[model samples]
Target: MGKIVGAAIVSHHPGLMQCEEFRRAMGAGEDSDLIAGYSRLRAKIEAAKPDVVMILDSHWFTTGYHLVDGGARYTGTYVSDEMPWYLHGVPYDYRGHPELALAVEAVSRERGGYNRAICHPGLERQYATLNLIKHLRLELSDTPVVSVSSCQNCEWQHFLASGDAIGEAIRRSGLRVILLASGALSHKFNGIDWKPNHPRLFHESNVSSIENIQSDKGAIALMADGDHQQVLERWQDEYRQLPWEAFGAHYLQMVGAMGGRECRAKGEPLSAYENARGTGNIHIWFQP
Candidate 1:
């Protein structure tokens, strides 16, 4: 199997597209920031020479557990003014990558009673990123690409299974390296009536919660006790303390799930661009 060499967690906030201040700092053109980040991120993957790259997003699937089909299927749910679509049937090109699609279908079939519902209707940026990745895969010959959405139905285990599948596929394909996982850290909404200057807000506090959980001493323990409320409360306490620069927690959780692999190297923060509206990018890297 190809070894995982690098990983990163990034937030795909929509405001990134409008943040011109960030563009100038990153020396980027007028294209979308999501596209730029993906380009830079893909460059890192190519430099690492990994066999596979996996991108995880928190806002993809619905919360439901039902076995549908198996093998490589492009099943997704979309909510946009341009195309409002929900795909429940098998993909037309099931024969292209039948095994992986079969695995997903089997899991969906076995996990019945899955609550498949959309939580938000405005997360078009995620769908845009998904399309961008697909386009990149078609244009680039250096790496085999796989993408999965972690909508409500997906748990940590599901993500782990997907990673395992990618590893297995790469081994079978005779690739020597894999670049797995991309996401971000704690992200509190701006609508909560909280100020960045509040004493409770900062990166250290956010990192503490993540470190605590990763160390197996934080809310995960409470979650184990089935005390989701307590876990939520504890997280809320931490979230209330976060500063503007550290608003990437939701993305971080997805990255942490794909742990146990070494990063190639870590990059310095490229830029810290903030706007009058209080959203920006923290461009850093973890090369495996």
Candidate 2:
């Protein structure tokens, strides 16, 4: 039977695409330690050898209902309109898991989550999905993938339910899967003109919250115990207001999809750093 062999919740910043020398020249590498941390994460994923990687991309924003890319092949060039200088002319090609995507949509709908699968050839893959291949060296042909969007108009519970439904569907379909929540923990950016080779800029309000999230070990602990409600409450009260990408729901979706009942800490904390705009980027791994 197909099973979820492993899972990860990591940062997906455009800065991760820079060369080591560029990262050094920019002086951003020292503070975040993202290279070493992600290196370890990549090794762990390689060892798992999962059949597919399902990315919960925060950059994908759908209205009203959740959407999945049902295309059999995903190919595109992603030149970040926001920062073409840093991310221009980037190309990506990946094999898609259309059957599994449709399964997820049907299961989510049955669970009352109301998600759908979409197929549009020649569409550009968003940075949220592209960064997975670019930074982690994940090949789509080797490990087929399905991309899910974080809907714009959904309640907190809806997000959690969708995750649970996806997890169940993956199990039912017997496909080995990995869940990746691709986003930052805190997200207050400097103006677009900020240079790349500088210490990340920080806003006053989010700094402490970023630090708090870094220190909190209960994220995995809460999910392991099936205390998703507590996890949700803690996130809202402690870190949600700090302006995380996708309101930090990406992490919860991952936790809930793991069945939200592990009841013990399973994650190995990885790295934490500030994004270009002074937001927190944390990485953690769970082996279930």
Candidate 3:
């Protein structure tokens, strides 16, 4: 049977990729400390040597249906429509896993969560996805990847169900998988381009997020026990998480698919300023 050997919730706040001056100003140094957390995840991935890396990014959005990149290869230069200056002309080259994408589609459909499988001769990578591939150095890993869209306009519950379907598919496919959810905690942004070490924009910043993660030892602890409803209630009450675009929805799929297992974090976090915008960035990881 296929198994989820590794899973991570990483931040992709653009600055983690496109903002070097901002990082230097804030003392993030040459290598972004926030993205440094991905190294541990990378190590776990290397050890497990997963067959496919399945990433569900908020930016992989579709208007009407949950979609998968079912293409055979994804190669192109990426530029963010939102912020072109920071993320311009990003070259990306990666292989796609059409089989796994189709499997996810079948599973979602079987579970009554409709999905779309889209393939093209050549497909472009979204900004968030490009950041992940570059930061994690996934292009060098030789593992095929499948990206899923957190469908636009779908109810939050739809994402939850889709996550369940994904987990089910992974467990049964007999293909090792690594799941990554790219997002941030509190996604409100600051209008001004604040300098480095700018304080978080929201009242409930990384402290609140870490405390919540600590209480459960990671959100997956609560979610793994099928207490996802309780998890949703707590998140709503404690943190009015506004996903950066499709951010919250992206993570909802990860949390829903956790299957009641804890992904204990390792070592100290590589926390950094989320961006010039008022958000918090914490680099967290779990052992395989």
Candidate 4:
């Protein structure tokens, strides 16, 4: 049977796309730990040797239905409309796993959930998926990859259901997979006028507030302890109140696929928790 070999919640902040000098300058003479964390994550993924890597892309927002990229091949140059100058003219070429994606669609339907695989040639790419590819050095390997979108209108439970369907589909497909939750936590941003006050932009001090930092750390601690149930329990009462990136759908879906509240996979800290323009970002790997 197909099984999940590895999973992780990784940061995809735009700053990581910049050159080392720029990153260091913004990080108070330190490159973002996430940059180095990518190399470490790469090592672990190589060891797992997954047949395919599926990224739950927080930025690839869709309405109503959760979409999966089912294209056979995608090759292009991309420039982020959100930050064109920072992430511009990046070339990407990768094969897609349409079979696995279609299977996910089938499983979702059988479960009365909405997951549709789209193989349209004109479907655009998002940085949440592309950034990880660049950082993880997926371009150097032949591993096929796919991107799953976060439904903007879905509530917490809906996302979890989608994940559960994804998990079942992976098992039936018999393809070992690595799922990457590509987004951040407590994603409230500093106001545009605050740049002058926050010279060291990437430091924890620059995070939106102390409360945000504390909330993020608390969630991280639970993941490290393999206490996903508590995180989900606190979602509505606590964490969800904060402006989590993409409503934290990336993480919710990833954990949902792992058996939701029943999952006991502990996370290893691949990188220290850091700040990205007031958002909480880190790399924590969960072995499967």
Candidate 5:
């Protein structure tokens, strides 16, 4: 049977897309810890020997369906329309896991879940998914990758139910999977004019507000303590107000698949918590 061998909540901020030299220049002589975090995350994933890498992409926002990219193969040159200058001319070639995606869809259907696998090759890719591939150097490996979209209208429970379907699918398949929740924590950007005054762009001080920083730290601490129950419980009252990246769907879905509030996967931080244009970003791996 297929199993989720490992999982991670990782940062895929566009800042990581820039070359190390430019990143160091922006950081006042230090590269973003996320740059090194990718290497360490790669080692952890390698040790898990996962046959498929499933990404819960916060950027792939769908409205009605919890969409899964089931394309047989993906190949193309990419440039971010959102920030073309910062992330451009990136070539990607990766195989997809159609069977596994279809299995998730099937399980979702069986469980009255909303997950749907779209096998069309023409579907566009998102930086949230591609950045991880580039950072992890996934093209050098034989493992197939697939991405799942976060439905824009989904509440925490909807995401959890969809993930429950995915978990059931994984349990029935033969592939070993590594789940990547690719996005940030608190995801509010600073006002445009702030950049000129803030030369130290990547520092935590650049994060939107001290409150956001504390909220992010609190959530991170909860993850480290393997206390997702508290995070989930406080979502509607405390955490949800912080505007998590993509509604925090990436993390909600990942933890949901691992048994939702009952999951006790302690997080081992791979990168220092940092700011990316006022957003809270970090890389943390959860042991399986």
Candidate 6:
């Protein structure tokens, strides 16, 4: 087995828009700290010099229930009857990868249904991450990178599986591996009324939460016991301490996945900053 030489968990905030180097490469203006976060993240990966890097972002893929066939067999989630139709049929075919149509067709046959349920919004996020990876590959010399959006169902399982796959792939390539979980602390979107005037309030609260979780002493403690409500309540209580506008829990799942990794290293406290669109940057990292 290949050794995990380095690991990191970072927020994909738009702060990358500010970096002159990133702007020239991506030909885009910096809008939020999330973008800047990704830019800095890519730099960090290059510096780490890992043979392979695995990036996990919550925004990249949607959660769906469906199966896809890869010539020999069908593979998909069976949680809900909802199938991942968005990935079913596509116009373009990528060589060596599953054909969209075949995969969808196989899923239809196995699931006995044409009612394709899709996680469209989730796929869009995945596409964004893909776009970032493409840019990174193009800008940095050919890095032989592979990307995969975590499955929608039981994200933790998918996270673990992805890590395992990366470990195996690295061993085959005979290179050290680095894992990066790209996400945020707490951020509220969707026009929610909760907006704290000071970014520090949100940042401090989230950092505290993460610290608590890492130490096995916070709301996440309840989460481990399947006490979801209590977990939410605890998070809500933390939110209450901060200004109202801070909201976004999906990012928390990413952190939870990092904490679960057996070979994972300790996480460090992250700083926060505001960007062009008022989106706060919650910078975090975990190393192994």
Each model's number of backbone clashes?
46, 6, 2, 0, 1, 28
Q: What lDDT is reached at residue 138 by model 3? A: 88
What lDDT would each prediction earn against the true structure?
0.37, 0.71, 0.66, 0.91, 0.91, 0.38
Put down candidate 6 lDDT per residue, 1-288, tens digits, no spaces.
455565554444433423455444333332334454555656666777765444444454434522211222212221211223322221211111123323333434453433122322222223323334443452244343323343455333333333343344344445555555554333433233444443433233333233332322343234334443443345545632331111232333333333333333444433333322232234444454
Preferred candidate (lDDT higher): 2 or 4: 4
Measured on C-alpha atoms, candidate 5 has an lDDT of 0.91
- Give candidate 1 misplaced runs (Cα > 4 Å): 15-39, 65-128, 131-143, 151-184, 192-283
Query: Lowest summed-lDDT stretch of 10 residues in model 2?
Result: 197-206
Give the distance in Å from residue 140's predicted Cα in candidate 2 to where it truly belongs: 7.4
| After superposition, candidate 3 runs with Cα above 4 Å error | 19-22, 28-31, 193-230, 238-247, 260-276, 286-288
Give the per-residue Cα lDDT of candidate 6 at 81: 16
Q: Which model is ahead, 1 or 3, in terms of lDDT? A: 3
For model 6, the run of ten residues with the poorest summed lDDT = 88-97
What is the alpha-carbon lDDT of model 6 when measured against the actual structure?
0.38
RMSD of 1: 10.3
Q: Given candidate 3, what's the lDDT at residue 177? A: 85
Q: Give one digit per residue, the lDDT tens place, for model 2 in 219-265.
A: 54554454656766676576565556787667767777876544233
Model 5 agreement with the true structure over 1-288: per-residue lDDT tens digits: 889999999999998888888999998888888899999999999999999999999999999999999999999989899999768899999999999999999999988889999999878999999999988978899679999999998887899898888888999998899999999999999887875335667777788889999999999999999999999999988878888998899998899899999999999999989888889999999996
Tens digit of per-residue lDDT, candidate 3, span 1-288: 888776766777776674656666544235456655667667767888888987888777778888888998888888889888777888888889887788888988887776767887476577667788888888987678888887878877777777777888888889888878776655555545434332432122332234433433444454344455565766554443443347477767775666522322232334443332555455444333
* TM-score of each candidate structure, all chains considered together: 0.47, 0.85, 0.80, 0.98, 0.98, 0.47
Tens-digit per-residue lDDT, 145-212, candidate 4: 99999999999889999999999999999999999999998999878776633566666777888999
User: Compared to the true structure, candidate 2 yields what TM-score?
Assistant: 0.85
Error of 3 at 96 (Å): 0.6
Global lDDT for candidate 2? 0.71
